[model samples]
Target: MSHRPIALEPAAVDVEVRGGIRPADVRHAKETVAALTRLAHEPVLRATVKLVASPHPGERRTAQAVLDVRGRLIHAQATAESTRKAVHLLNDRLRARLLKTTRDWENLRGRELRDGEPGRRHPAPPEEPLPHRPRREDPVIVRRKTYALERAIPDEAVFDMEQSDYDFHLFTEAATGQDSVVYRAGPRSRGDGYRLAQLDPRPGLLGPVRAALTVSPVPAPVLTEQEAVERLEFTGRPFVFYADAATGRGCVLYHRYDGHYGLITPTPA
Candidate 1:
């Protein structure tokens, strides 16, 4: 129904198979990798898969996958009885990696506004978009959501948010790291203006960097955990709800690209 594979860009898979001197072993290694590569094109979320074999490991082979998205890297390692099993293990590992990648990319949206476009000079590693299928709970809000901001000078911040596909773009003061927000800032009717959110308590360990879906077209606001709650109560403008304290009142409000408002709140009753 919804985009199943969250990854649009495929991660490069590298494998090293080592075992007994058998032709099947070699064939299986190649086949498994070929399968994943082919899946990448279908809907399994694949990019480039490279397989290598050597007699170094002898009896056992290891799977090492360096899953990277927009420079965000996650390493997965698994040992298996055979190269086929190892590839399967790597497949599972990549699924988990994408989950983490999805959440992190969402949060990065807030910081990209002023930080300049992601992958400008060092652009994201060459990868393909993986087919994304949303879970029942992970509903599909929208597809290909797009918005244009006032010429956000030094476009790096905006670029990063685009790369991550965040609901709201958070901007950092050119020299000061002070945070600002840019989303549909005017009345829901006028549908214009991306206001600067008011962050509170600022951010620290166990911080409030999280946001709610109701905050913007795409929910995560760009601000430190401490300042995440600070918002200007402008009449008729989209604003974020927040609570800042150990008393358990804080949230990073935002909207999914689908137009669903969400609240990334703290753990309370």
Candidate 2:
């Protein structure tokens, strides 16, 4: 399930610039948010970001940046003689939130699932916290293998997705002559359900070597039918995976960790 790119309300974010803040200061704050949106899209992690800029009511000396996700918002405020300085600090707070979110997603993706039984998975405790370190490239050891994708009926895509431990599966659509993708979504128990997103990366970043947008999509709240919802259910130890399919693009699924899940989707480079 993935949401195609749309103009989101960003109901989660609210930004207020104070009297001391200049127009440029607000611009910087938006720039910072945009930068983090790009950085957080590593193949291992993804997010849905919406930004809002509004007038800072009263006391121009203070500026505030508030971030919201899943109905929870974290706000940071600073009072400075100049809005630039205040925005500087405000941007820092937002980055901190993004950093924490990225770390959480990393922990989820890097889960050490011990194979206690044939198909049973047991979670491992997270590693000791690492000291603050700057991100610099330490040349990665690249590995490569190849496989041919077989055409499958849409229902067949569901079977393949469920059977695999990996988050995504590559396949061909029986109806379309395009190389398509199928991804899994859900940890939704009860009324929660699963979604399978399809994507075509024929217009990829590279001709011979193209990589699909490697993240699950985020879902917008919508009414689900009783019978249709019945078919979208999943049972897992503990993970949250809600997904949506945009009108065209691909799908996004909420991941289920022990207790946390975030948006995943494919984005243009």
- Cα lDDT tens digits, model 2, 1-269, are 64232221323223453224455655665665445443342321222322222233332243445443333333444434455655565555555544545444334323332334211222212211111111223312122223455666444543344333234455555665333555434331221223433343223321221111132243322222221122222332121222223323222222221112322333321
Q: Tens digits of per-residue lDDT for model 1 on 1-269?
A: 54443333222333343334355544554444444333221243333332333333343444445434434544444445565665566566544444434544455445532224322212222222211211124332232222222223223443344333333454432422333353434332342423334333222211332211122223234444334422422221233644434433334454321223334443433
Clashes of each: 58, 25
TM of each candidate vs. truth: 0.27, 0.26
Model 1 misplacement above 4 A: 1-59, 67-74, 99-104, 108-269
In candidate 1, how many Å is residue 256 off? Answer: 43
Mark the 10 consecutive residues where model 1 has the least summed lDDT: 126-135
How many Å off is the CA of 188 in candidate 1?
Answer: 48
- Candidate lDDT scores, in order, read 0.37, 0.36
